[model samples]
Each structure stands twice: as C-alpha cells, then as structure tokens.
Target chain A: MSGAGEGPGHGLGGRPTTGARTRSIAEAAWAAAGRDGERNGHGRTRLQWLMARFGRGTVIGIPYIWLLLFFLLPFLIVLKISFAEFRIGLPPYTPLLEWIEGGYLQIKLAFGNFLFLLDDPLYVVAYLNSLKVALVSTLIALLIGYPMAYAIARASPTWRAVYLLLVILPFWTSFLIRVYAWIGILKNNGLINNALISLGLIDSPLPLLNTEVSLYIGIVYSYLPFMVLPLYATLEKMDIALIEAAADLGCRPFKAFLTVTLPLSMPGIVAGSMLVFIPAVGEFVIPDLLGGAGTLMIGKVLWSEFFNNRDWPVASAVAIAMLIFLVIPIVVFQYYQHKHAERAEES
Target chain B: MTDTLVQGTHSASSRPEGSRPGAVLRRAEARPIIEIQDVVKTFGDFVAVDQVSLTIREGELFALLGGSGCGKTTLLRMLAGFERPTAGRILIGGQDMTQVPPYDRPVNMMFQSYALFPHMSVEANVAFGLRQDSLPKAEIRDRVRQMLDLVQLGPFAKRKPHHLSGGQRQRVALARSLAKHPKVLLLDEPLAALDKKLREQTQLELVGIQERVGTTFVVVTHDQEEAMTMADRVAIMDSGRIIQVDTPHALYEYPNTRYVAEFFGTVNMFQGQLIEDEPDHILIRSDALANPVYVGHGISARGGATVWVALRPEKLAISRVQPDSPHNWDQGIVEDIVYLGGISTYHIRLDSGALARVTTQNLERMAEPDITWDDRVFVSWRHDNTVVVTG
Candidate 1:
C-alpha cells in the first residue's frame, strides 16, 4: 500500500502515473516514439526502437535473410552462370574458382567469351545502335509529348480527364498489336503509302518500311504516352495565376510560357525522358518486328547467342555487361527519386 | 503624358468630388490618367460588368470595392484588357482600348495571388516586361537591378520566387508591374494573400508606393477597410452596378442609398415611412421602432413613402438619461455586451424585438459601463450622425 504522498494530488510522488505507473508510461513513451526502423511496427520508426526490438532473430538477421533469399540469390545464380564454361565440342559444364594447387585460381572459369565479344566489333556496333535508337526515340517523343501534355493541362476539366484517359488507353491495349499496327502503316504498300498514292501526294510508294525511320516510328508510338503522362502530371500541378501574374508584370503570353511554364515543366520533361529512354533501350519487339534482320541491336545479339549458336556462357556475359552498362542511369534515377521524396517532405 | 488629357482633366465618367476641400489637398495636384466609358462585359447569360464608368486620376490610388460575385474584378480585367467588354469603350490617355489585348495595353496589373513565376528569379520576373519591349540585354539587367533595389529585394535578386515570403513576393509582383512604367497600374486584391497584420502594413506601403510612383493605381478588393485605408477614391459596387464613388470619409459620412451605406460599412437601418421633410433633415416613422427618426441628409420623402434611416454603430450614443440628442430616442434592454479591448459593443434589444448596436469608446475606464445586461436604458444620436437612405 502507498501513502497519500503517492497520490496525484502530491505530484509525481502522489500520482499513480508518477509512482508504479511511471515505469509503464516510460515504456509506452519509448514504444510511441518510433515506428519506421521497427520490425513489428514495420511501416515507420526510429533507429533506437528498431535496435531495441531487434533480437538475435532481428536487427540484421531477418533483413539479411530476406535480402539473401530475394535479391542476392538471383545475382549469385547469374554470377555462377556467367563464369561457367561452355564449348561447341564439350557439354556445357560448370565449375567454381578456388586456389587449389598453385598461387593462381580459376581453372574452368572463362574470360574467353568477353574477349571474343570485344574482338568481334559487331557487339560494339549493336550496343552503339541500340543507344542511338533509344536516344532518338526519346527526343522525338519529348518534342511531341510536351505540347500534348500542355494542351491537356490547359483544357477544361472534362476534356482534361478525357484526354488523360485517351493518352493512357494505348498502354492498356496489346503492346505487340500496336507495334504490328505501326508495321502495317509503315510498310511499302501499306495504308500510309496507299493514302499518299491515292491522293497523288507522292508519285509512288515511298521507302518507309524496314528502315531506321520505321524503327523510330514504332519506338515513338510505343513510348509517347510514357513521356506524356509524366509531363502532364507536372504541368497539371503548376499554378495558373502565376501565368496571369507574369502577364500583369507586363510579360506577353509567349514570354510567360517560355520563362514560367517551360522551366517549371523541366522536372516532368526529365522524368518522361527517363521513362521513355530506359525501356526503349531494352526494347526487342519493335526493332525485330519492324526492322527485321537489318536491325542489329543488343537484344537480337543476345537472342542469337542463346538461340542460334546455343552459346549460353557468352549470352550470360553479354547479359551481365548490359546490366552493368544500365546501372549508371538506374542509380541516377534512384537518386532523383530520393531527392523528390525529400522535396515532398520539405514542401 | 504632356500630349494626353490624362494629366489635365478628370474624365467625365468620374463622380465629382471637387467640392470637398480636403479632396483637392489630398490629391497633391496630379490629374486623371485613366478614362473608362460605359464599359459592360457579359459572359453568356451573366453580365459581369454593367455599364461601369469611372476615371482614375493620375497619381491617385482608387479602389473598386465589392464582395465576390459582384463585378469589380470584371471591371478591373476590362481595364487590363484581359477581358473584352461587350458594350462600351475604355480610354487610357484618350486612346480607345476596348479590343486591345492585355499585353498591348498600357495598363499593368498586380494579381491577388502574387503570381510570381515559380521558375524565374526575382530579377527575371521584373525583367520580363522590359524584355517584351525588346530592350537591350544590358539595359534590361540595369532596370531589373533598379526595380529589385526599390522593393528591397536586391540581396535576393538571384533567388527564385518560391524562396520569398508572402509579403516579399507581393513586393516582387508590385515591382514587376511597376517596372514597365505603364500609364496606369491595376491591382486585383493585391494584399489578399498576406495575414491580417501583414496585409494592413502592405496596404499602407502600397499607398505610399503609389504616391512615389505617381501612376494611377486602380485596385479591386472585397475588404472595405482595405479600400478605405489605401485608396484616395473608393467605388462601392453591388450586383454589377456602381453604387457610390466618393472619398472614404464621404462614403461613410454621406451614403447615397441603404445598400451603399450597409455595404461600405456596418449600419443599423430601419425601413420607415416618410413622416416629415425639412430643409436640412428627413423624418421617418419606422414600424419596428417606437419613435420617428430625423436624419441629417435632405431627401424627397413624402408621407407614406417608404425609405430608410441609417446610423452607424459608432454614431449611436447610449446613456441612462437622454443626452440632448435630436435624431432619435429609444428605450432598450442591454442584451449582449462584448469587450473588444479598444472598444466595447452593446446589443440593445428594443421593445419591437429589433436590436440596436451601439459602440462606445473606451476613453475612460474609471468605472464599468453605467448599464449592465438586461438594464433598460436610452439610446440616441444627433441629427448629423444619421443619413437618409433609399434602396
């Protein structure tokens, strides 16, 4: 039993919370303090609570296990597959590198596949061609998409919703079918040529089919929405009174657009460019279906190595090289995303 | 300009406040700059501006006062040439600007939202107008620097608009609008974005800036206090019509109608039948009140003709005994008493169930108010304190 001094009237000594309940309240305070770093809380907490909750089964252990099972496991498999030996005469055999006899290791692990790829210049050409196409397509898409996005932003509310729906509807349709439709349109005797000839605008069918131009058309068609959506999102968020303010400040409409509207839309432009460029670089369906055998891209080479030559090890090396090459942009994009989060919080 | 009539004569559309002795003294010898004719704007079915005609004199700060849904903003937009009037004309320096677009108009506006270009630095926002005129790059830079220095934003010249405070942004917008040196500058609720304290300070600063710049500033605002505190002339609007255009003192002291009196400020009004019409005063018998009221303004009030008598809360005096008052007398029970620091207001419940609000000065605090809640007392005002109004 406690005395009257332990009651709430006597402050901490008198109150139940100050006395026995003090310890429980402290525990509750600690519990309430954090949620992110915590495992059970899971969504959000601080480092201390996370550390406190972390036992032998927690802290680094669970995360390590999850990371190993999901992320590192796939990479390990790819690494092993990449180094395993394969030959035309020998059954594709595999081995791990270890310093067994001499000071040097790697008895079966081969660097010959990468060496052959470097010596052959065709692989280099393919990589360069893929980069060129993706870059060109991204530029074209941005040029077309920005105005379209701006129009959507400036349109009335009903039209904005309708336009946005139309822009994204292409994504819902079969992507392969869209590419095939472009193929039909770009063919030598297809609808575009037929229409021009019928109108006598062109003397005859222009050579549009199976060229770099056709490949470009297909890529831009597929990725235009990707560019537009981000631009639209950014444009929509811009305040309209700012434009009026610029005009009030004596700026003409065009000048207001150049200084206020255009610069404000840069983040959207960059985001759209990244979205279009990343996928277009890896695209196989468009070039293969539209350009045929003339389009020598990394995807085609990768397919050839794995299928036509049955060179599994070489294909794996090419895959690993492509992944390494891609890491630069991915890391940049991730950094941008992190910064955007910080901006969101600050605003 | 020397060539334009704007610098010599006030436009014919403006209400003549020439007789007020202080109006001439307050103007400091500048003339009218902007002349707006019977300008009317109709958007489909809704009439946005209804034959609104007014002239803003050179170097004078004029305010268009109204609540939202009233046509003050539409009238301002017409002056800016952002909106085209369906009927009538706008003359800036005697040049017809009815169809001219906003960019080509000599008048510049400061938007209520500040509308600072988010992408541009403070200098760039101010430079935009100069650049449009195709000024040399060096000249543009020099002018931008001068404008920024005027607003005390020289240290923040390179900083983007989002970095500035609301008041700072307002100044930037103001500087930018003034940078072009238009014949007239228009403002649309310019200080609406700031907090009450900031808004008041900015209002005074804006009026001071108007004086220094010597450009006709025509502002549109919903706040009567904003209109009263900032503008040399206040135009009260209601339902797409200009009700009264006068100096702030004139508007409060002598209103033309019941609506004008009530809209421009708080008014205690009683709908009455005209009982007597003397040379300098009007007498009206109201159904809601027990006594007839004598208003100072002479009105053509015939017997049985309905009219209104308006007395501001501050104009009404409350006491235990009649204080030799002449306008009207009433016995009321003090219903609600609110102490508002600087002043206290009393809601006196009359026998007719109507409430008379009386604001007494807190000049002496030696004792509590002589009357308490539910205490029956006399409320009265002098003839000069009341005005005759017709809806």
Candidate 2:
C-alpha cells in the first residue's frame, strides 16, 4: 500500500534509483504507515498510503496529532464534564447523553452550573480581582526589570555574563522555596519590619503580610527573571551607536533613552509583559500564601469549588469560564503580536 | 647638486599655508577654528592617545589616517566630546569645550556604521536632532525636508531605515548629523561600509557637501586612498602619536620618516650611511646598490650618519639596456611581474639580495611586454625624485 504513494514522491524528490536512496525512502514510508496504522485500523493502510503521498504531510501531521492528544483532547473532556450534572457516584457526574426506549436520544446538559456563577457575585469579583492583581504585578515587574536589563545589556562583555547569571540565580532554587522565602521577608515580624523598627522608621510592626502588597511583591519577585531575560535579549542586540547618534544630535542622556532605547525595546516589553501577566492571572500559590482572606481571585474560587465543595460540574464550569475570559485577551494579544512580527519582517 | 637639495627643503619649509589645497583663509592668515591643545587620553593603564596637539582651520577638511588601535578614533572621539581628554583642553570657535558634554557641544559625528534609528522614518531620523533642540515644528519639518533633499533621499523620507538600501541609509545618517548645523562635523570612516563603486561616488558627494556647508570637518579613516581623496590635510598617526601632518600632496611627496613614507604608498628603501654632504647633493653608499646612490636633497644629518633614501615605485624607471646615469641606478633581474591593466609593477632581485619594486605605465597596449621574467634590466630614478630621511 505504501508503494502506491511512493510513485509520485519518487518523481517529485527526483531521487536517483540507487539502492541506498530506495532503501531510505522505503524505510520512511514504512515507519509513517506503521505509526498511522496504530491510530486507525490496520486495514486502512491504503488510506494512510494516500495521505503519505506527500511525505512532508506526515512530518507536519505529527505536531498536529501531539497538540490534539495533549491539549485539545484534554480541553474537550473538561468541556464535556462542564455540561454534566454533579452527582455522588464513581465518576461523580451524570452522563451527558442517554438513549430513550423509542430510538430517540436525550441530552442532559447542566447549564445551571454556568447560570449559578452569573447569579453569584463572588465569582465575578474573584475574576476582577485576578485581572487587577495580574495587571499590577506585571507593571511592577516591568518597572524593575527594564533598568536591570538595560544596565546588564550596556555592561562590558565579562560583566554582562555576571549580571545575567545574577538575574537567573533565583531560578537555581525551587520556585516554591523561593516563594516561601519571600514570606519570611514580608511577614509582620519579618526582617524588613524588624530592621525598620530598629532604624526607628516605624514604632511597631506594620501589616506587611497577608495583604495585596505582599502578594504583589511575591508575584513580581518570581516573574522578574522572565521579564529581564527577554528585555536583555532585545536590548543587548540594539546598536549602542543609536544612542550616541541621538546624543550627538543634541539629545540629553535621558531624552535619548526615551527616544531611541525605549522604542527599540518594545518587542521585549510586550513579550515580558505577556510572560508576567498570563501566568500571574491564574497563579494560585502566591495569592493563596500571601494574600489576605478578603482578597478574592478566581484561582482560589475554583480550588474551593473542586476540593472543598466537591462540585465537579460547577468547578469545570468555572474553569471553562475562566479559560474563556483569559482567551479574549490572549487572542487579542496574539493578533497584535502577529501583526507586529509581520511589520518587523517587512521592514 | 647639494645646493639644489638645500634650496628645495628651504623653499618647501617656507611655502605659504594659503597656497595648499582646500585652504580657505579669510585674510592672508588662516584662523584656527578648532584647537586640540596637548590632548592626552589614557584608558586604565593604557595610554590610548599621547600628548597630541592640532589646529584645524575653518572650513578645512582634515583627515586622521592610521591603522587600528592607532588613537585616531580616540582623538576623533575627544573632539566629539565623547571622551574627555585626561590632560588637555579642546577649544572650538575660541570657546573651551573640554568639559562640555556631547549634547551641549557644538559638534556632531556620523558614525561608521551609519546608525540610523531603525524604528524611525528617514524624515523623522533627520528631524531627531532638531527636535532635541526644541525647535519649532514648522522649522523642524522644513529643515528635515531640506536635509533629506540635500542627500537626495527625499523620496525615501517616509521609509524606515531597514527598507532603504545601504547607501540610502548612509545618506540619511549624514542628513541627521548635519541637521543641527554643527560647528564641527566629525566623520568616523564615513565611506567605510559602502561598496567600491558607491564609496568612490559618495566620496565626491561628501566633499561637495562639506564645501557647501563650509563646516570644519575632521574625518578618521584607516584607508590611505580615502584620506588622500577627501582631505585637504592628512595627519599620519601611529601607536598613540601623530607622526606627521601635512597636505596630501606634501605628505606623499615629502614624508618625514620611513613609517610615513611606507604607510602612504609602496616604497623601496636603501639604508646607507651618508658618505658626502656637498652643497648641491648628498651621496649614500649601501650594499643594496652596486654604486653610491645620489639624492638631490641634503638633510640636516652630518656626514657619516646612517640615513635612508626612499624611492616611490612609480618614480623608478626600468630599462632593458643600462642607462647612461652613473648615480641612482642599479641592475637587477626581474623576478616577478604584476600586470594591473594601466600599470605593471616589476619586482627585481639585485645582487645584494634586495628586492626593489618598479612600476611603469603601459603607454601602449601590447599582448607581450618589452620586459618579462628573468630579464636583466636597469632600474633608475632621478635624484630629485628621492626623499632622504635621517631619523
């Protein structure tokens, strides 16, 4: 069956009918058919042969299959569960479809779970709070990371390596451990409060822990390296002569930075902002540990619905809603990113 | 013969500065617009520039010619106020600019890489300097248009730097640097990045623009031909010091040392002790020459002192038969011949094992030359064509 597809590929590749070339082509076709046969039935080898006519199709199809199995399949299952009714059973959810006696099918979808979210103000507040936290933390990370990246990029080659290592040094430790370490520094009786008290800057310990400030500090600290690395990659590639040319044309140092350095590093800024903002919106650890009980975020609400309340259907609905909410911004961001990339390539 | 040599040196030394090429003196005397006074720059234990002083007249195109790491760039940077000299003062238009920052200094530079802002359009890049000065919007727009037209990049004004070709980007950079109308314009290897044909064309354009603007221009370049083509006066620099500064013609004709002579063009050196120092001529006897070589130039060196007589390759004439001249002539066998279309250079191996190069113009086109490999020929130069250096 594979031999049928090889006829056209042989002509297209213009491969000589040497023993080695023929053997390699045969092996590739066999391997592709073997993989396809495992998924579809073995009797469908002729179909696989037709699909494999263009050898490049098989190579391109591998990544599509991987994405389907790993990402789309799991997502569809969660989406299916979101429409099922919650029940105390082995699977803990009612079947979405049932066959009636008279050859008719009845589909039972528990859209009440989705309606319950709109009815309850808690979920809406949690989503709003998540977006606010994510936006604020990303801004803080950008503000701190930009200068460090610029300084590292402008540093001499030997010193540049040292500074870059320092930026990545926090990653050497486990991420949870790094987050936990921040707790000690931000607590009411932590080193910062103790030092401030000793310096007479404060009479007593401030409410430093279990607050939005602490949560922001933790999020910014963890995601700073992500911001700095990308910004440095862009800033390091920038020509320093651009700044000199600006200065030579009567621009002051700071104005030169705003005009030349800042605009040129926009790609890095966008990348770094997305890197910090995306994961931060759904981040559970930092807010769970550092945020006050009053602080509302969707990740915490989803966690409570699944583990504490044991409402699998509602939890899945909440998760689907959160994904939909996140998808809007992500799609918009990706559209702009694609447009920017095309513009850059054209220029 | 020695008297003529002394008279040549005296007349050359007394040649008025106003008579030099590209010299524009308002009065009989030239006024120095830019003064680099005993400038010394050191970089962390390395002396990048030794104590150097130079006076650039108004509207003169000057060139600092040197190889890599020769301090020419350091000197140019100092003039641009990018690097502050560790020891000396820089004065422009009679105002001390030693302590002034680059932004405040009335000078601008065109970088060698043509660093046009990639994000900005050609017109915006040209307007950048004017915007920095907080100029009025209408005036900035007018200046940008005028400058872009000056570089003939008006059509490309709306295009980003990456969209423009290399030569167009260079012109945009030139427009941007000149938009501010700086008192002194420093060009760092302005034509270095251009291709051969474009570079030759741009060289003339650069000279024309400089003359039209009448800005005191200082260009730093390692290419001798580039310096010779564009500059009125060329400063030959080596290591961390200036070896000699003179007009291009003078530097080529009367190089003061072996370094300057060899640096400017190809030269054959005959090292010998000075045998006689008569009023009209001097004689140098070297093993490279079968007989003593006569140079119609008397140096300040005493007789018996070691000196070198440098002869340009083009100055030496090769003949199939021995010449009647007794001095400044040698017989050698042609070891190699390089034909370069209009001129052919012959490498001759003399009895003393010294290889001398003689270049002659091909006046008539022939498939075969009169002289070929292994042909014994006489190489001779007129005495007045030779330069004698005692250092």
Candidate 3:
C-alpha cells in the first residue's frame, strides 16, 4: 500500500491516488487468495498449472533421455570392456568384478591392453595412415564439390532443386552396392583402359585397381554429397549484392570470388570437411574393398583384432584410442562453431 | 568538356522561393561529369530503361526519382556499369564507358542492403577497395582511418558489420564506397532500410558528406521527399522514360505535365478547359468550380484546350466566411478534419460534387476546432498558385 502511494501518480491529484488505492486493495486480495489455496491442500490445481507452464521442458527431455540411453550407455559398456583382460570365455573377456574366497568381493583392473597399443609400431603407423587418408579424401571432396555446389547455388531457382536432387540421387542406392560398383570400374581392363584401347590410345591395360588412388576415388565419391549439400546451403543464402559491392570496389570477378564468396562460405566448408573427415578416418569398407592389402587403417586393424585375432580387450582399447585421436579435430570444429554462433547472436 | 545543351537554364517563375536555391545556382555552372546518351536496356522483351538520356553535372547531388518498376534503378545500375545498355552509350569524364566492365569503371555503388562483408571488420571493409589497387599498406591504413572518421565511426573500426547497429553499418557502407574516391558514387535507396526519424537525420548527414567530398553523386530513390531534401537536381522517370528533369523547387512549382505534379506530391486536380490564352494571363473554366479560374501567367497552348489545374493543399485557405475573390474561391462543407498536432487538414465536399483537401496551420491554442465537420466553408487560392498542365 505504501509503495502504491509512492508510484508515478503520487503527486498528481485525488483521482489517481484513489485509483492506486483500489489497485493495492485488489492486489492484497489476490495474495490472500493464493495463501488460502496453499493452506487448504488444493495442490492438484497448482501442479496442473506448473505442468502447463513447463510443458517445453517435457518436450526437450525426450531427445536428452534418448541420447543417454542409446549413445552414452553403449559407450560406457565399451569403456568397461576396454579395462578387462582377454580370456577364452563366454563373453571373451575377463570379468571386472568377482566373488573371491570367504564370500568377499574382489575387483581386478588391467592396463595391459593400453600398454600393448603403445608398444606396437603397427598401431602407430595405422593411426597416421588413417589420418593421412581421411585428410586427402576430405581435400579431394572439397575440390570437386565446391564448384558443383557453386554452380547449383547460382543456377535458376527451378534448376537449383534439380541439381541438388541429382547430387543426392546416389544415396538412394545401398552403400555396399555403390562400393562394389567402383571395383568393376577400377579393374585392370575396366572402363578407362577399355575406352582408351578402343580409341587406339592405349596398347596395354593399366593397373587402376587395388591402389591408393582407387581408395581415394571411392572415399571421395561416397562422401561427395555430404560436402556439397552444406556448401550449397551457405552459398545459396549469401546475398548477391555482396559480390556486386566487391566489383563496384574495383575488384575483378575472380578476385571478388576469392575475397567475398570464399570467405563467406567458410562455415559450410568447415562443416562439410568435418562431416566427411570424421567418418572417413574410421572407414573400413572402402579401404578393405579398394585399398587391397597395402593400405592400413585403424578401422581395419580393429576389425582384424576383434575377429581374426580374437583379442576383444585389445580391440576395445584400439577403439578407445581411435576416439581419442578424433577428439582434437572435433574440438577445433566446436571452436569455429562457437565463434559463428556468437557472431550470429550479436547481429 | 563543354556541353551547352546540358546547361541549366531557368527563370524565376520555375524555381520556387523556399527550396535550396544556392545548390541550384552552384550546380548550374559546373561542367557535366556524366552523359547518358539515349541509353536503352531490355530484359528479353520487356524494356526496363528505354532510350533515356540524362546529364549529371560535377559536384552535383543528382537523384533519379520514380516509383517501383519505373526504370530509376535500372538507369542508376547502367550508370554504375553493372548493367550494359542494349543501345546507345554512356560517357563518364568524357570517356566512353559503355564497354567498360564494373571493375574497370571509375564508379562505386552503395547497395540498398548495405551489403557489407560480414566476414570482415569495419576497418578491413573500408580498406578492401584500396587493397584491390595494391596501394601501399600504410596508405591503405591511413585512408581507412580517414574514411571511418569522416562517417563518425572511428570508435567502431574494429567491430564486424554484424555487431554494429543499422545506422553504423550504413555509415560503414558509405565509408567503404567512398574510400576509393571514385569519380562518381551511386547510391540505390540508401535510407530505405532505416526508420523514419533516423532516415531524416541520415539524409542530412549524407548531404553534408556529399558537399564536403564534392564528388558527383547519383542517388536512385522512390521517395520524393528524400530526393527533394538531398538532391541538387532531380529527374523524374516513368515507364522506362525520363519525364522531366529540373531542380526540386522548379519541379514542384512548375511541373510540365499532370503525371509529374501528381507523382511529386499531393495535389487537388481539376479537369478544366482553357477559355482564354494570352501572353500575360490565361483563364480556365472548370466544372468542379463555380467560377472560371484566372492564372497570372500564360502557357504555350491554344484557347479552349483541355488542361489540368493542380492546386496544392497547403496553398488553399479555408474559412467559414466567404472570401472576396469570386474566381478562385469555392463554397464547400467540411466533411472531415484530420488533426496533425501542428496543422489541420479539412476534407471539403464542394457544391459541384468534388472533393478538395485544404490544410491550414493551427494559429491558436484552442481546445476545439472553430471549423468542425459539417460546417459550410469557403476554400480559395491565389491566382499565381495555379499550375496548369496540358498532359
């Protein structure tokens, strides 16, 4: 009541003071009603109101709980296996906990698997090779996808949708089938050599299959859509006036593209690179099918350790090491994303 | 260098009393910087700018004013070298520029969207054009600083365009476009994105900057008020053609056609027949008025010709008592009164069944209007206020 008397209408006249008094009286009645309701144990209405107010929380909880159950739970299980010793048993690994003598529980932990990974040179070489292959493949995809994305982005509106659909048209087929088709084209007497020979340009078949080049071709072809889609999205949304402004500033077309268009599409480039690099690092199918026996990647090493060598503990440890190797690039990607988000918020 | 045909020649009757006459006087003697010789642009079959010829003098703030789809923007684009004319040629600084690309042309354009590079900071955006010329690093830095200071955005030099306000971003765009000191600067609806109050302020600031720099500026705008406020000379465009070219005062006071009068501002129009045409004076007989309207000046038209009489709303005086004048006064009943704080506009319905708008300043601090709705009133104008147009 005192606060109401000291409000904006304090010095005016009788009419405003009387209006403020009536408002204060009404506010007091509302407070008394709330207290009365709480004391009478009428909690059902209050609970219903709380639920109505916080319904968005319930909607957000669905995906949160899903990630906990599906992703985090499986990861923890693998982590537990990575700590146990290997043995010929039902689960093919030693138990983390057991009941020893006198009905006392004993816990056993092993660091031998992690130690073995560091001791062996094959693991070191495999990790480096996987990094090299993923980096090379990501670069190849970017070089090929950027122009395609730019062309599609600059196309007419009706043609833009058509070109985008054509880029993703390869995805409707099975991944395994697509990889298999690459084998036929990259064989010794495959399409390239056959065409050259028929055109009288080649006298002998070329060794096109089972090489690093073939592996790169396969990886790039498989992940080209992932690279092109993000690039197109950013390029299409860019204002065409920025290019004009650059030209009006006395920049030639190519220089304008380098200074204006390229820098503006960097977010898409980073996003596409991350999307292709992370999966290509652990890619097993393309390396096994096209890389033949020479190419060594961590995914193949992990596969052989789990199946051929039957070292489940060592395989789990290798998986954990591979995850650690990926964390560095993911962190860099996160930093760029955070910077972009801040810039967006400021605007 | 010497184009006698493009020189500005006018009489006192054309240029009104209140506009910036000094700008007109200064621009009338300056040499023409840009000559657009019957340029035509067509997008497939639809013509955007059709055989439009214009001349912009050096150190003049010229505006191409028109409504949307009226070829004003297309003409500006052609001047900026972004759009090549389908016919004819353009000359900038006495050089043929029709074949020159936008990059090679000595002109810069400030886009309506302010299209500042989002990836660069304000300092870098202003330095971008200088860098393209491969100027010394120290010179580029100094010029960028100088441009920023000119726009009063020196404190925000390090900020990116996204972090700046709309007005700040607008200033940065202006600075970047002017950093190169191009022979001509083109602006496309520069203040359309700003709010009304800020727009008015920026308009004056832009004029001040133009005067300080003394660079030839060609601004394209659909807003008549902005053109009138900022431009030294304005060209009205419509349907891919130039309608009339004159100073703001001349364009308003002595419009050559009905379209120019209606497009520039609000006016009450009367369809009348020229009863008498003389060297000193003329008479118009309008069915919307009870008596024939007498004009103080004669026009180049025959007697008994169909003409339009355009009377501005502000020029008419409204009162309850009948005025002494019989020819220019009309009796009407006030149908509506729009109170606009400083002035009141009365919508009157005349006995001839025509609607007329009369605006008057509120001279007294009265609680209620003395001339309310449904009150019979007389609205009259001076003989010199009549603008007779044949088209």
Q: TM-score, each model?
A: 0.84, 0.88, 0.88
Overlapping backbone residue pairs in candidate 1 total 11
Worst 10 residues of 2 chain B by lDDT: B1-10
DockQ of each: 0.41, 0.66, 0.65
- The residue ranges of model 2 lying beyond 4 angstroms of the native Cα positions read A1-65, A197-203, B1-28, B366-368
What TM-score would you give candidate 3 relative to the actual structure? 0.88
TM-score of chain A of each: 0.74, 0.81, 0.83
Local error of candidate 1 at residue B214 (angstroms): 1.0
Fnat scores for every prediction: 0.60, 0.92, 0.94
Comparing 1 and 2 on DockQ, the stronger one: 2
Better of 1 and 3 by lDDT: 3
Native-referenced Cα lDDT, model 2: 0.85
Residue A158 lDDT in model 3? Answer: 99
**lDDT agreement with native, every candidate:** 0.79, 0.85, 0.87
Model 1 chain A is weakest, by summed lDDT over 10 consecutive residues, at: A1-10
What is the C-alpha lDDT profile of model 1 across B1-391, one tens digit per residue?
1212222222321434433656757674666577778888898999888888887778777899999989999899888877888998888887888888787788888888777776567888888889888899999988888877666778899887767888889989988998888899989999888999988766766765666678888999999998877777889998898999888888988899887888878889888888787777678888777777876656765667888878899988888885564548887899999889778999999888888999988888686777889998888888778787767
- Which of candidates 1 and 2 reaches a greater lDDT? 2
Q: How do the candidates score on chain B by TM-score?
A: 0.91, 0.93, 0.93
Give a tens-digit lDDT track for model 2, residues A1-347: 24434543553444435456555655454555546544435555533554555556655666888999999998998898899988998798998889989998999988999999999999888989999999999999999999999999999999999999999898889999988887899888898999999999999899988998888998899899999998999999999888888888888999999989998898889889888888888888888888889979888888999999998889999999999988877887788689778888886
